[model samples]
Target: MLPNEFSSSPARVSGMDVGLRSHMQRIYNRMTVGVLITALVSFYIGHNEELLRVIFGTPLKWVVMLAPLAIVMFGFNPARMSSGALRLSFIALSVLYGVSFGAIFAVYTGESIAKAFFVATSMFAGISIFGYTTKKDLSAMGSFAVMGMIGVLVLSLINIFVASSLMSNVIAGVGILAFGGMTAWETQRMKEMYSSRDNEEMASRMSWAAALNLYISFIAMFQYVLHFMGQRN
Candidate 1:
């Protein structure tokens, strides 16, 4: 009786598998779209020095830099935000990141930037695949990666004042490692988040939130990878 009650019927199991795949696909699609928006905006801003100066030259740049962090604060409270609000917040955050990251063009050669981008994409794909396919539980690794990320953020702030190029490079290197683990862990967690009982609105809000998580991980890894691989202009 217990075995019969606990087992899912074959059709039910098949339906569940299909639903899981569909949900996972939605998360990936959303994440991809967000990444493209960021890349395009970054490229556009990076090419126009005048616009870059106008935005980054003054105190207003603080808002550009801080806005992404602010969106992340909102993202942490996804339970309170509606799906539309969460989606708009993600878009705003991505554009803000692009604007802030325009400095990459000022410092790195185009060829090096392209090379770094290609390599980062390949690496990201591999890590994400591992996370999706692996049976190993990554929950602890996720916690550790988050701690590493906090350390990197704090060190990055300190290095800004210290003006140490070596330290900056070190930070970038560590950032790649930290965000690499984060990408895999985030993928696993996103997969684990699927619930058959969720309503459409709930699923969508969660999807937006998960997409933001993956988008952040991907962008951070790309930036750090580019920093280390890119040639100075």
Candidate 2:
């Protein structure tokens, strides 16, 4: 949120200005592509009754639900892989997420889902813009958001055993607020990670990493919002 605290030569500052813009654009572009892929994959699966039944009706659903988490833990490592590899893995992760998310359509109407998507997009854009433009430091908020997310995760797991709809709904609303804050924090962190001095490869890797964070935040926000709008048959 604060202005450039990193002291640098005038040439370096100029380079950073241009490089940061380009790098940010790359991150957004990668993230957008991933989101499109996810939407397309989700729609295709959700709209086809046979495809949906085949995946969700059997033991395969466990693999679908767990695959994304496994991939995120191992596949997203920025240290071992190249930028191009990470970008590809990022798209793969989105597809996995989409497969898991297909069940939403079975539970909610398409119109409600569309409405929630727009609401999420609007919220994400505004929150990310504030992160990019604000003067106040969001690191504190980020820490709080992380804590809130952990609390929500724990409660959600508990609810799975308790089977309490009221608690589930409350967690969903809290999750939306937590992820909104996380979106801002992640955007700020991604921007701060940029440096003109880095090599193109490093910059690209960082962009993919940022994209991953933003993508997760956006998806989480959308899921939480959808719970509120979703209607039961």
What is the lDDT of every predicted structure here? 0.86, 0.87
Residues 1-233 of candidate 1: C-alpha lDDT, one tens digit per residue? 87776585777888978988898899889988888888889889999989888988988899999889987985545788888888888888888898898888888998998898899889989999999899999998898889889989999999989989899888898888888999899888877888633798888888888888888988888888887788989
Model 2 is weakest, by summed lDDT over 10 consecutive residues, at: 1-10
Prediction 1 TM-score vs. true: 0.92
lDDT at 203, model 1? 86
Please provide TM-scores, in order, for all candidate models, with all chains considered together: 0.92, 0.92
Identify the candidate with maximal lDDT: 2
